[model samples]
Target chain A: MLIERKWKKWVFFYLPMAVFIVFTLFPFYWMAITAFRPDNELYATWRQPNAAPLWTLHPTLEHFVGLMKTTAFPTWLWNTMAIALVATGISLVCGMFAGYALARLKFRGSEFLGTAIFITYLVPQTLLFIPLADIVRDLQLGNTPWALMLTYPTFLIPFCTWLLMGYFKTIPKELEECARIDGATRFGAMVRIIFPVAIPGILSAGIFAFTLSWNEFIYALIFMSSADQKTVPVGVVSELIRGDIFFWGQLMMGALLGSVPVAIVYSFFVEYYVTGLTGSVKG
Target chain B: MAIVTIRDLNKKYENGFHAVKDVNLEIRDKEFMVLVGPSGCGKTTTLRMVAGLEEITSGEIRIGERVVNDLPPMDRDIAMVFQNYALYPHKTVFDNMAFGLQMRKYPKDEVLKRVRDAADILGIEALLERKPRQLSGGQRQRVAVGRAIVRHPQVFLFDEPLSNLDAKLRVQMRVELKRLHERLETTAIYVTHDQVEAMTLGTRVVVMKDGYVQQVGEPLVLYGQPANKFVAGFIGSPAMNFVDVSISGDGRHAETEGLRLNVPDRIRAHGGKRLTLGVRPEALRIANGSDEHGFATKVDVVEPLGNEILLNFRAGGAPMVARVDPGVRLKAHESVRFAVDPERLHFFDATSEAAL
Candidate 1:
């Protein structure tokens, strides 16, 4: 409001907005162009007379077809989907219960327990993986989908629990009290009233858990050394490049396609997701 | 219907702070008992303890001869309407009304019938399909009422349920709630900070302050005969006028600076003792000529409320408001004379604050 001039508005508002949009969108644009460019054009030096790194003169689905036909990319996609979904489901259930307990129940050490759960989320994945890899071998779960499926929850559960804990606190305690007065037991009231009212919070927690598990790298890479069990991130890096050579097109293509499921999940729950982040409940 | 009897009830928090002192009350069957207090008076704590939402520090609560000190809220068979209307966001009004029955394992048809019946009572049959968010604030309050009534519980509890509503809607809903209680004939304990709401809605009103019960009686009884100075002042709008006065001439009259008032015979026993005189705003009137009891004052301000006018004045060094006929015209800061009817005058011991 203070900046009344058109040029001043551009200097203060539109220019900064454009810079942020371009900064965020450039990576996706690069990924898209690289995914469609022919291999010869992708590999050509920028100095070559006909070479263009920013835009391709010709775009083709060759890399996508090659990714499907020549590599285990299809297998990788399936592994990522299955692992992400199960991990998200496991974490969401555990998060909802643990979160409700931490937020609503009155017991000794509940506050300490909540802080401990949040502390676990702050633990770096790199340090955690060292100890986790030992446990993974002790359980004899290495090189299987179960290795990552079970391990992803260690991090994802803490994240989901902390998120859901805050969300549950935003829900009024009166709802549960009213439910109890309405002849529902404590557990009954939680399930019937609290959980229903917390749908936005639950959906947002699920989306975050799904995205985190889908983009997971170190666990997928270390746990599954076998070709068929590898997820998209590991499968692309391991299988696409030969020694002293890079498969830039297929690498970009994998990253591009790998993000679609997470994108779709976000778009579907965008409304609930916003409120979940903002924690605004009407009535 | 059930009688809720609470004996020697007390509530002390985990931090060693006592919020409710020993309180004993018997809510008779079908009685609408209101606990009215200012903030921090523990009225809500008492109601919550009755609802089994708060643990009683030490007491016995009997609902129809069953000591429910350790019973859970669900087993207590009471329905509470919360201030925020606590409607499940994901459920339609129909589902919200039906949830309690479903949890109790009621038959499907019976659940539907109860929901429809309650909806009909609240005039929300058309809103059965809508979620709570789809309704306005007043409609949502009605839905909350519908949810509470659908179960036909033995007792009803209300915790400032109308405080969130607008003025007109609150008044309308207050009447509706009274009518609902009559039709249901269930014992209820209501807690509200608004004295007006308590006076209008309670069959018997319990006025509390600082975690202590100040007075309990019918509205007019509490109004006409307040037990203490606090009760006398707190129960009325614009507040009662209080001035320190000393007995004059055999204690038949009390005298303040430039004003003299006849004391009641009960208070005249302490002939030379200083006391506080209490007068309700409406009890003061414009003095006519030759009135012996008239006190002189300067009108400080005038508030012309359409039906009547209030004269704000200073008499005997205490600010006071007087409800006068709208036809009476007086300018602010103008000197005026006023008198109090002797019967309406209240006298209290200055140290004890107990009414005489």
Candidate 2:
């Protein structure tokens, strides 16, 4: 009876985890399989079991090789990297100072300002595309990375500032008070004391900003009229379709490559990313 | 060394709640002054005001003759140890101790020397390389003290610094703090709600209640001659017992429900009025059958410590506790005769609760 009960409990615990793994990971599995499949095998119908590739068929890197040479994939990758890095950098510098102020300092209308920033974040990027396109034209930033750089922080800063405010608040007020009493000025205390302790929160905010800027499509599509200036998201989608005949293999490859930098960034700061993102959810 | 003076210090919160009301205190140089009271008693508010953490509502604070009302905390040239230790979690112990000196832009070698010297004094030299999270609670406390010691500030403000430690470590740290204060010869203003900590560590204790200073004196003086019922009840461990009694004569003698006692000449002038009798637990003794001064009571509980026994009993329909030798074998429901030491007895005006 005890053995049966123990087995039942173990099964209950593992069931949801197993379901989640299969449900979420199946697409990536199919992508990997298609990425490695030869062009002839990729077209094989799965409806007839025997028509699909069997053990006898050899795998090929033809899609990956074709993906590299046939498109402006490298330039799109570089553009994505540059815009994401610069946007994340700008967001981080602005977010840290703004976050620290919101968390610690007493200033006039701070609550109103914080709420205003958060509300601004709730406004969808898609809704601002037309207005932002005109603004980009007015600023002469059209068909340039500057348009994307200028647009990304609009979404990033408010959320990032709110994220870091929650993180900074968790740090004991006494730690900063101790610094102040020890003859360190407010700025000195923040730099020497509070910032070091809040590194995980800052890292998560940086990753969030980077990922948002990298994956952004609406502004990039609307603002970048030239193909040379297109980011990976817009570039990949536009290039995949020519007169309604879709290139699935190359399109999937572009999608896969586009996600790699964010995945790598997530992996490097996965612990901090989880903590930092969850920290913002409460605020 | 510095004489710290606070004149009519007041802190009225934004919502118009007055936390500290016209508090005035003069702490002598090298004196370990302890500000003690229950929570929300304005003791901590006063300490923070002194440390420049809280802005003074309307008052002057002078540290060694320099009016510090308008100065920011960094400009006050004082060191503080927080109740939570407040060690920078990301920094090594050595860096934590050297932080103040570095902030003052002291040269690297001088900062290192002072940090090392403080670490040696606190016996934390071996743990200097470890982060705050790596150290034990007691070690962290010592590091907090070391952080202050390295500064060598004119005054040190400690806000319940040892309140976070375990009982044994708190007792140990209390002794270490006393010795440190003696060696440093700095004006130290410590705050705690623990009367034992206040009594043991304070050269002079300032007792506060409801944003008002009740009394300030040596520990024994406050214990023996409390200014009011609050101080009498607040100072002792079992707390001094209070019972309503009516004075019949010119305040020479008083009578209650099941007890009668002769009031001392000091209280004679306030006779023919209602009063409250205050007696410390240690002042009450098991009376011999022949003793003239005695009261009989039924024991409700008996708690035995290794060195002493605390007897909880009821006298005149009022709860009372008596501290006795551990060998005394009194049991619950047993009737016992006890005597209150006349010299240790305290009397307060019934209505005002102020000492008569």
Candidate 3:
């Protein structure tokens, strides 16, 4: 009787977990099946009796081949990688220093500056596109990747700095005081002690900055008007559609390919990324 | 070894709050001095001023022969072990101990040698490769001491380094620190709110209260000859008991509720009609018969502490405790006679609270 009751309790606990697994996993399973399905099989109607089985059909690599050939997918991937890497690099440097200053240093306007930086992060990027576009034009950066580089960091820096400021503050002040008394100048202490201790925070902020720049659509769409200058999002949306009739197979194929780099990045540093995102949420 | 002198040290916060006021002290070479008080008594502030960690509002601090009020902490050549242990969390114990030496640009062999020597002395040699998080609380504390030991600074500063440990470990570390001090022969200044730690570890203990130095002497000197009421109350466990009393008959005797006491001629020479009488818990004994200095009181509470029994009772409407022989069977709600040891009694001026 006791064993039976324990079995009943186990079932009760696992039912929701089983239901959630099916709910979230079904779509990804479907996407994988669709990605491998032949164009004929996908277009075939399922209304008729004795219809051909979707599972029994042979998979084709035609969409993948067509995606690579017809669109500027390779160039777009290269452009995205370059812009994201550079933007993430710039954001990390700015954010770490600003975060340390906000966390440890006492100055006249420190609190006000920290608040202002966080407020800037809350301001919508869409609101700044026009002003940023004008600045890009004034700087004669139209039809150039420099426009995206300049625009991406504006969104990334404030949020990264705010996120890291919270992480830096969690470190005990005594740790830094110990370093200062050990004959380190303030900057030396921060660089040697604080930065190493906050590596997980730094990586998390870097991933956010990278992915934000990688998947960014609006600024890339509005800023870079030329074909060679377009990032992955803008390039894919532009090249995959010619007016209304959609290139569903190739468009899906391009998206599948476009997502691989980020997926690989996520897979490699998934632990740090998850910790970083959760840490940012708490902040 | 170097002597540290702090002259007329004053520390005032921005809002006109004085945390330490006109403090003065001189620590000789190889002397182990403990600054002890209750919380917010400016003991830690005084130590920080000596270490150059806190700025002095006015006055001067000299280490050896050089004036150091304007110098930074790094230039002061003083190593501090914080209450929290403050070992670099990301670094291994070896790195934490070697940090100060590396910062001073000591040769690699010399840094390694000093770190190893400190680790050996602290009995943490095997834990050197571990991070601070991996070690126990005691081990982390030893690492913090090791960090300071490697510096071999002119003066060592410890701010309640044993307060984080359990009672047993605190006592154990107190003994170890004293032994280490003797072995190193370095001038050391320690701050603790625990009177036991201060009494056990310091060659000379400075008792402080309300931002002023109450007394400075050897542990027993402060215990036997407290300079003021605050010192009398602060320097002993269970604290000294006080009673309001008035003197008459040309100051030959003093009277309070429930009893009358003969005054010592030495105390009468100070010439005060009203005073506070201080008697340590051990100074009061169960009187065998009626004595001139004996008083009758009701035993309200009895706490047996193995070695001694703390008897809490009411005398003249004020609560008091007496440490008595444990074999003496005493119960609550019963009456007993207690005699104050005339020579051990301390007299303090009612207005100034100064010792008479």
Candidate 4:
């Protein structure tokens, strides 16, 4: 019976888990292998003898070196970093205040407003970019980093607000009330008590916003026209794959490098991110 | 000087729930006043209104001599301990206790001294550097209390502060809170649904039901001479037994199924009228044979508690329990006679359910 149970456990849990891990991670593994494979091997047909399509005998850094030397990858990385950071900061501040107000304050239309904000978040960015493009052009922000930095918050704010609002609700309201009675004003209580307690939620929201803005495509593509002003995702796709010909090695190299910052960010706050999403406050 | 007065207080939510109705109270300096009732009885709502945490629909609150109706909680010089303690999870015990003093911009050394002093009194001086999540429930309670006492506000508001603790810890904290009140002498208004806590902790207890004040008096006075049926039923443990009975034509005796007792002379005018009679469990005793005034009934269940025994049986066609001497042995379904003092009887008008 115990042996059967163990066998069942492997089939139901571990076997499926292994399949899922490979399924999700196989793309990244493929990217790394292709980026490191020599040009001759990468282009070689699988039908050729000793072609080794899956595994390469020879690995080289030529793709990474060539991509950096020939393209505006460095500028794209810097632009993505600067835009995502500013955009995340802006969204976090707005979301914190809006979320707190929606969660704690008792104003007329508060529930209606909460649902309305969430509805705005549900509106697809695909449809929003057209009208936003017109506005961005009218504001004379096109072809500059300001265009993406300002427009990224349009969706980022609502996402952050909804997440942080749910998080703030999980924090006991009594903490703020006790603070108010302990001599702090309403605003003071929010800043001192609610905000500090909500750091985990805020960090999670910020990380999400950073990742979203970092990997954002449509807005960065539409707003930034200059080679140096373009963000990583748009820059890589636009610059590397010219005409119908694809620079598979360079493209894969760019993909791998573009994700490192976000990976580091996620790793740094992974503990807080989990707790924030789960919305657990000790008191 | 720190007397807190509440006049004609009312709270009606936008959803049209009338939570508190024309409540009036005066909490004297150095007095421990408790507002108690079942859930939704407006006890916590009334306390929150006084704490400025809830908006009062119409009321005037005065702290000291000032009419503080428009004042914020901080300006009113009041502090509150919530049911969940509401300690800042990120802060150490010292910071939690010192938060109020620091907010008021007290000097650095003075804040430290006051926090240390309050922590010492609560016997939590050893745990000052730990976070609230690290402390036990009882320790967190002390820290919450310490936070309130460190400020020495004009009045302290406790919203069922001990309800979260286990029963044993609750009892321990109750005595400690009472002793703390005696030592500090700050006017306080505490809210709870537990009758025992109200009776033991409050110098004066206010009983509420359905958004109305049922009775406000000393715990024993509320117990002995309750203003109405609700007060009488709510103030005691095991509750006062109520039986519907009709008075006999002689203007002296009241009768019901399986029970007969004399109506006190003061309420004899209720003769020939259907009324409700109430008797507390402790008032009944096992009667010896040949006791003319005793009523005979079969015991349904005998619970022999160590110090006393509880006899459960049907009286007036309703289940009733009697507290009696543990020395007298009894068995379920066995015939027994029980006697009650005439003065211990309580009569209420059947229609109004008001004490007669």
Instruction: Please provide TM-scores, in order, for all candidate models, with all chains considered together.
Output: 0.96, 0.96, 0.94, 0.98
RMSD of each: 2.0, 2.4, 2.7, 1.3
Q: Write model 2 residue lDDT over A1-283, tens digit each, in one string.
A: 9999888877887787889899998787676666676666778776756665533256776666776888788888999999999998988888999999999988888999999999999888778787888899999999899998888888888978998998999888898899989887789889988888888899999998999899998988988877778889998889777879877778777888888888899999999888776653110
Error of 4 at A258 (Å): 0.5
For model 3 the local lDDT of residue B238 reads 97
Q: Any idea what lDDT model 4 has?
A: 0.92
Ranking by lDDT: 4, 1, 2, 3
Steric clashes per prediction: 0, 0, 0, 0
Best by TM-score: 4
lDDT of 4 by residue, B100-162 (tens): 999999999999999999989999999999999999999999999999999988898999999
Candidate 1 residue B99 C-alpha distance from true site, Å: 1.9
Per-residue lDDT of model 1, residues B1-356, tens digit only: 59999899999999887989989899999999999999999999999999999999998999997999999998988888889999888889998888788878899999998898898889999999999999999999999989888888888999999999999999999999999999989999999999999999999999988778888899999999999999999888878999999988597888989889876787768899899999999999998986689898899899999889999988889889999999998999899999887888998889999989
Can you tell me which runs of candidate 2 are displaced by over 4 Å? A47-50, A53-57, A277-283
lDDT of 1: 0.91
Model 4 TM: 0.98
Compute the lDDT of residue A92 as modeled in candidate 4: 98
Clashing pairs in 2: none
What's the ranking of the predictions by DockQ, best on top? Answer: 4, 1, 2, 3
Local distance difference test, each candidate: 0.91, 0.88, 0.86, 0.92
- Give a tens-digit lDDT track for model 3, residues A150-253: 78888899988998998888777777778888998778889998888788789888887888999999999998777777888888789879899667667666
Tens-place lDDT per residue, model 2, B1-356, is 59999999899998888999889999999999999999999999999999989889998999997999989898888899998899998889998898888888999999989998998899988998998888899999999999998988999999999988999999999999999888999999999999999999999999999899999999999998899999999998999988888887767677888898766778777778888889889999899866787888899999998799999998866898999988899889999899876777888988889987
Please give, for every candidate in the order listed, the TM-score of chain B alone compared with the true chain B.
0.98, 0.98, 0.97, 0.98
